[model samples]
Target: MSEFNTTAFQPSLFILTGLRRLAGSRLWLGLLLSLMYIITMVGNCTVIHLVRKERSLQEPQYLFLSMLAWADIVLSVSTLLSVLKVYILGLYEIAFDSCLTQMFFIHTSSSVGSGILLAMAFNHFVAISKPLQYTTILTSSRVTRMGLAALLRAVALMTPLPILLKRLPFCKGRTLSYSYCLHPNVMKLACGQVRINILYGLVLVLFSFGVDSLLIAISYVLIFQAVLGIASREGQMKALNTCLSHIFTVFIYYGPLLAITVMHRISIRSSPVAHAVLGNVYLFMPPMLNPIVYSLKTKQIRTALRKSCKIQRS
Candidate 1:
């Protein structure tokens, strides 16, 4: 039998490019990403803490918000060290398995975030459409089930990524496009045929991100329809106001993802710096912005925060 092709070598280590073009501006980028990471951590943690400590925030909507916060925390943390290593410490060597693990968590947590947002959209619909039965429909137990299902779905859907990636040979250069591992970014560096990888990624994105976004949009459409049926404009506006935070959140979550997905397709002609910047934005913006948006827009969160502060001060 012919010996295995010598050219198809698997690398045990992958090098993260880590915004190489910005080597001249590493300090500013490092400081900026570091501060953003810090804020992401602080903001998400504060949301989780407030949700746990405050009785008024024990409702389904707030509970789902807390789940989103938890996912954001995990999503941000998954990439934190790797990014710091690349930007701050000038380290690019990540073990293959370590890179795979990071990729799994990054994608899984993002999926989890999407799932939680879908649940939140449903919560908004239920609250507006059937106010009298809002509590009854989204009881504590049901909310728990919803959250659990979201997480389980994320894990199940993302579990194949690392396994599939490990089976592929990587004779291609091992330099990754980003400081962290992404399924597409890593797969792009694999040698030989990668049609399966591309197809699988597209399928995953369709079933996960694409479906969730569509469902969330439909939920809002139904929500708007319900609001329009109300007799007075003020009442319609009030009902719609309740969904403002969720709408903002959906925007932040889906907008960057859509941009990144499109960016990957056009990456050949796109500026490398644009690719790096947008990918980081896609990862970091939602985590950093979600809590701030809620705190500013939602009355209940503010009220709960004030009460929590008073109790703690006492």
Candidate 2:
């Protein structure tokens, strides 16, 4: 761990610190992650398919749900090869270029997911507060632009990570903390000063999750305020129920993330297994569960699914 050098750079391979040679838990972890990957793909793909198939689902809310599904699919896919190789095939060494690519996609897709949640929150607000204007406000063209904007934001923020790390020499051992590459974990492996990388990583987290969470909270507050004014308990419950799925999705996506961050800061001495389990939970839970929550809770999605199933059977 010395200062920065002026020599020409050569890439080095890094190993993923997957499940530490559990005699049996290793097998179980592989099977569990495999199942999760399958479920995530199927669940999210179904949502996207249904949103495309049903005419009634062309509205803004379901449109955003489909985009979220797409982002989840990308996120899950970004980790699948590396994670499965580490856990199942016992392969650990990843080429530096590939690792950089993996890190870029992982961060960008996660950022895209956060942005999508913010979009969903705003969609819920518009639907709840200004029902009549929802269609006019969130036109299909506007929704398309929003999706593109989210992707662009992710790309802009994460583009610097691999480049910055490339410049620094990683005199520290080439071992990552998890089965996947994250900017925070990877940057810490660099030898020389990494204040710039650390600061930029912090900036990405704050802008992506911090700001989005705050906006979501504000949206919910306004939505609840409008719901409470509906004058009947049943009507109030109905209005509030519309937000339950989005709220739950947000919780599933961000709750474990926040918990992990808190634990990292406060319990610097926590067990490795605890961190591993929580990281897997944060990685796998939202993409696998989001579609299920929406399909079960949202009448339109459920009804469309039922009709689609009956048509296929007939």
Candidate 3:
């Protein structure tokens, strides 16, 4: 271990890289990112507001939607400043501790988002399969408990990441592949034995995203079985329509995620721009699109939005 101690060095700061190829077009890129950030914040905040203010939206699904909006807001804020700093202000260096903090929040919020999606699937399942027990099973207190549980679980799972990263010696260049810090990207910079880190990350993925996806799929299958048992075609159509917004949001959230995962593990030699763009999309798109999807697909939200707008105008 004497040899290890001699070479061990902790970086003071990490460099964040945006689209290197489009360095000259930073103004446009920054503007776009800024716009996306604004939309994400506004959209999610509106969802939260609508859920809280509108008495009609106090149901389990809308409450769960509000929880998801909160997650999206957290996720977007975690990345917003760092990304803007790099692209807009040309300030790419981030302090080591700050990077770790960002990574923690980002991962925690992401896990929470995934968990919320799972909870939503369960919500849909209960609403469809056991309509009578839905209110009894998912009372206000229980929904609140579920939300807190998701937050706590995410924190518990992601807490180890920053600690593990802090212990390792980072001798590689301080340049991060993306504007924000991620466990795998940070781990790649460590010169010390990181087998434990890699294994832990894989464990996180398997237990969180992997397990959540499986459960969500099972929930949908059960939902389908319930739908099929409905005697009338109109009832079946109405039931399926309730899931359209959620299904779209799920696909939007997971598509870039799957691509990013593939690029991280398999196509390691792809362009840095590809990695950066996909990272941005994974972080940005779901948050921006979720509220829109729900608002468009769910008539209630649209009506509430219009009512809110007219009230403001008056």
Where is model 3 more than 4 Å wrong at Cα? 6-8
Maximum-TM-score candidate = 3
Give the backbone clash total of model 2: 0
Model 3 per-residue lDDT tens digits across residues 1-314: 33666234888899998775674867888899899999999999999999999988999899999999999999999988899998889898999999999999999999999999999999999998999999999999999999999999999999999999888888878998888988888888887778889889989988998898889999999999999999999999999999999888888877887788778778979898889888888888999999989998999999889999999999
Clashing pairs in 2: none
Candidate 1's C-alpha runs over 4 A off are 1-8
Q: Among all windows of ten consecutive residues in candidate 2, which has the lowest summed lDDT?
A: 2-11
Tell me the tens digit of each residue's lDDT in model 1 across 147-168. 9999999999999999888877
lDDT of each: 0.89, 0.86, 0.90
lDDT of 2 by residue, 1-314 (tens): 44446133334689888666455676778999999999999999999999998999998889999999999999899999999998888888888888999999988898898998999899989888898998899999999888889999999998998898887877667887788887777776776767888788778878888998999999999998999878889988988898899999999999987887676546878776777778788889999999999999999999999998999999
TM-score of every model versus the real structure: 0.95, 0.95, 0.97
Better of 2 and 3 by lDDT: 3
Q: Pick out the ten consecutive residues of candidate 3 with the lowest summed lDDT.
A: 1-10
What's the lDDT for residue 306 in model 2? 91
The pairs that clash in candidate 1 are none
Better of 2 and 3 by TM-score: 3
lDDT of 3 at 183: 83
Winning candidate number (lDDT): 3
